[model samples]
Target: MSSLPINPPPRLLMGPGPINADPRVLRAMSAQLIGQYDPAMTDYMTETQALYRQVWATTNEATLLVDGTSRAGIEAAIVSLVKPGDRVLVPVFGRFGHLLVEIAERAGADVHTIETEWGQVFPVSVIANAIARVKPRLLAVVYGDTATTMNQPLDELGEICARHGALFYTDATASLGGNDFAMDAWGLDAATAGLQKCLSGPSGSAPISLSERAVAVIRGRTKVEAGIALETDEASPDVIRSNYFDLGQILDYWGPRRLNHHTEATSMLYGARECARIILAEGRQAVIDRHALAGLAMLAGVQGLGLQVFGDVTHKMNNVVAVEIPAGIDGDRARAALLADFGVEIGTSFGPLAGRVWRIGTMGYNARKDAVLTTLAALENVLRRGGVRAGTSGAGVDAALEVYEG
Candidate 1:
């Protein structure tokens, strides 16, 4: 292949995730690389931990970054805390909930799940009743499932877990920073999130926080790596199976000890740190409010285009909206047209929702009035070109503008 400079097309990512990264985050990622053991790198790590504590609305000392995608954080939190033969209860509201089940099972957890319809969320009572019967060691669920655009209510579930003596874990990859999530206030034992969504950064780093209870469980399963092991270090039978995903080791690396783990992805650390810094500088709640406002505009815009919003609207996430594909247009075709003709990229659904709905996100750096209006205009034009029978000439844009102006 001939060598060519990498110049990509401009795309407004109005999709579920991996949205447009904030320019500041991009700049941060471009900074000069430094050794992992450098004082500057350690200081950046410490500052990142502090920033994420504010972002996650927690004061937990165990908050740190996992050097992988959001799922890596999920796996780390699961595998470290859950030993083989432990029972893990998962309430499946959408795709990510099933992901938790898969991860837990891989960790040798005896996973049991109660599932609701794809577009709906499980009520607290239902999960509580399941916990009552199953008496699981850990309760895992997704805070937001982008596939269905639903935000699972977790506030009450923590107390329910407390009542049942179960550890509470939530994968907040899709919802963190864009939606209302209080890790400490909600009594969450473990919570993991990615930088992509409302954090306005790439997906390489996962910011995770663990309550003391969760940390204690992970410590029990700690095994110092063979290469770094001291003569006095003892290995336990219940040690975490994966060295790479071991939270105990990761904690040591992130904590004051500064023990070497994997050579930290320096660029991703810069990006993650910058993401948290941007959120904190903007004020966490203010960013969430911005996402909420943008989401409402998108929702109204789609509705004005005479499209039906999917799922329970009250339970929908503040970052993405699912709209039913109009009767006469192809969902994928419309999305492709939006991308090719307008340089705007929307998302299609998964599992049961495939071919039935389109997922448009107003998240990260793209969660703004202009992005929402531009996407809505492009979508309406595409639908009309595809011979859709519903929307008027300026209906979508008007609706969205009204939201912004109101």
Candidate 2:
């Protein structure tokens, strides 16, 4: 332990999520611990839900936090919403849609997928046609997949889900803060998110929102205790099989009457609240604009340096960009050098795209001129060391600067 360094390098995280945390969120988390049932903590919980609604651009009464990482929220929504024999339609453009199907299968749901290639977005009609054909009870998709660094279109699909009487759920873990998203307007019935991605915070809290229809469905399936009938009311019509991921019980705790569940992670709740508050303070639209501009700058810089992006350019995610690793440059060696020499981190692609592409992100507080410029420069130097063409070292930075200047 004594050999461990007391201080660490100042790292510039330009990768997918768990980006730099906001100082306010850190300080808020640093406050002295309080009992989970403390009135002050619950007050923060209530306020946190409200702030998240603003961040989600929704008035959903059921918006609240789950006590685990972003995956926890995704599981809660899937397990709670889909029961045995119910049909779930997942449009699998990337890893997350696969995850949805895998979880739904465990939850006893009949899963169906309309899968696309890794880098492609399904046409609105593709999803609409799938829903019309499958007539599923639930539709699950990811808003932004870090694996492919792509944002799926929602507006048309939301309307399609509404027409089919199916609930629409999205995992916005990688896009929540930086992208333009409107839960209600998009006709989304449910959505889950995390503070670690674009919110620029840690990974413990899972923020979720459910529409009234979603609430009624879960309320209809609530479970009852064997001997507590005398003390309480009838067994809930909606009995969720999994006690841990049940949203009904979760909503009960966050609602007016604070029901007992797990001791809410107080520091995480404060961290999430501060994350939302900071976004609120900045104005959601402005935050999105910053991500978009920064993304554009990076895109321009990468293109200027003669790199080919991996996927659909027009429908790209605002905070993440994926580019081919370029021929003759040792991908792993370049990434290691960039980190060792520059104290910067950019992500590698996943699954089929792994080793073929590199993913760089401009998300949350890290979506700025310096972050973009620094990442571009570091990458350029790394590529140069790996035998890339001359004169390309600052090409990316110069192109990105041109975007800001304009």
Candidate 3:
């Protein structure tokens, strides 16, 4: 076997997530490793917590990273906060909502779900009604679901949950950084996100924030593993089921206690830190406005090609759009051509929307005028070649330019 250093080919990822990481983040991740508790490493960790607080728009002292993909954060929050037989309410708008339900069930919660059509979001009144009926201990929702390119509004849900004496949690994996999210202002008790989408980095790290109330729930269940237990350290009988996902122990690692939990993933930490740094540097609102403009341009360009946009436009996320594939074109074949011929990748839908719509994203590093225009041009060519009439030549690009020029 030949021993060769690794190299990867380049392609512009214009899909829902795990998009191109920001170059600055890559460079930071390339920095040499450091011991987990080295003063420098701890300082980096502290700074990372501070940076993610801004990213999450919170003052939570419990803000930190989970050493896995976005789903790790989701599971950690659920398994820790939700005890067996507790009532949990999930408002299912898309695929990720189903994920919350599944995780909560595995955590032994008595999970109840209220579902909307794939392309629709729940009215606040509908959710409030469910909370009234279910009387759940926790209400879990997704801020954005790439499956339908819809964003469920959470501005009022948190206050509703508080009034009902239930905790509020949301997975912001697809909407953070590139969209408007206010963890404190919106009264969210806990929230989690990934670097792959709006944060503009790879997917191995999950940034999460927990309000003091949520932290108390997890702290009540704290159980230091048997191997690491001290004589004075008391372990709770209501321990979190998953060893690696115990957030109480995780907080001790990130907190002033400096307790060891696990060997930190240094490279992913560096990348997550850099992602937040870049977004805060650009101004969070400005970065969101950039995604909004790019998303609008993409929507306009696809409409100019005579394609129908999916979902409720008003509730759509600012970073991605779902466009209905034309009647006679093979959606997969057209996607293949865009990848093979143009070296640009878009995303497909799941479940109910599988073959009916294509999800195109303008997020993170790829959310720019050039990227939007290039995808539009490439998509127009592919559609025409696939024997689907996609407006006059250059119409798609021209329409997108109008959005940028405006």
Candidate 4:
């Protein structure tokens, strides 16, 4: 086999996630690596935490990065705060919601779930009623499920959880930077998100925030790693199940104590830090507005092409749109043609929506007028080639252009 230096072809990623990384983030990742314990590295870690505080819109002192992907952050939050036999309430509106239930169950929680149909989001009243009945220790849900492109309303759910005496948690991996998220105002006890979606970075690090109440729960189950334990180190009777995902020890590493847990991933730290810097520099609200504008344009373009959208558009996320596969066209083949001919990529459905819908995203660095118009133009060409009559010639691009003009 022949080997060569990594040089991948240019691709316009219009998929639901892992969108193109911001060039600034890529450049940051290319910097020279430093020892994890070095003063410079520790300083970068602290600065990154501060930056993410602004991103999450919270003053939580427990905000930090989880070494692995976004799921690692979710696992850390669930396993550290949820103990065996504890009751957990999960509302499943999409695939990610089921993931929360699975992670909680694997951590030995007695998980109870309430589910809505694939395209619909749960109403605040229904979730409130479930909380009152289950009265679980924690209420875990997904803020945005890419599987459905639905943004679950979190503003009111926080108050509901507080009234019912339950810790509120959400996975904002798909919605954090691109959507309106107010952690403190919304009364979220804990939140976790990935960098790939709207943060404009690669998918290796997770930014997480924990309220004091959530921190207290994790502390109760804390256990000091034996390798770094002193004679006086205290271990909680109910130690967390996973060593690597333990928030208590991770906090120590990021906290003033500067204890060692796992070796920090330096390049990912650089990428994550730059991602936050980019968000704040652009103004978080402005970035979210950009995503909203792009999403609207994409929607209008698809509708102009005479394509019926999937799910409840009213609850759709600002970063992605789901369009129904037109009648008499092979959904996968069309997507394949778009990629092969136009160097563009979109997403396919999962589970129930499989073979029924296509997901196109406008997120992060790619959430712009140019990206939206290009993707719509490519899609229109592909559909027309497949014999699906779009309205008039160039209707899709014209429709998207109208959005930008307005």
Question: Number of backbone collisions per candidate, in order?
Answer: 0, 8, 0, 0
Report the C-alpha lDDT of model 1 over 165-213, residue by residue, as the tens digit: 9999999999999999999889999999999998999989999999999
lDDT of 2 by residue, 44-74 (tens): 9989989999999999999999999999999
Local distance difference test, each candidate: 0.92, 0.87, 0.93, 0.93
My TM-score estimates for the predictions, one after another, are: 0.97, 0.95, 0.97, 0.97
On the 0 to 100 scale, the lDDT of residue 54 in model 1 is 94
The window of 10 residues in a row where model 1 has the poorest summed lDDT is 226-235
**What residue runs in model 2 are displaced by over 4 Å at the alpha carbon?**
1-8, 225-238, 390-393
RMSD (Å) of each candidate, 1 decimal:
1.6, 2.4, 1.7, 1.7
Model 3: residue 108 alpha-carbon error in angstroms: 0.3
What 10-residue stretch in candidate 2 is worst by lDDT?
Answer: 224-233
Note the residue pairs that clash in candidate 1.
none
- Quality of model 4 by C-alpha lDDT: 0.93
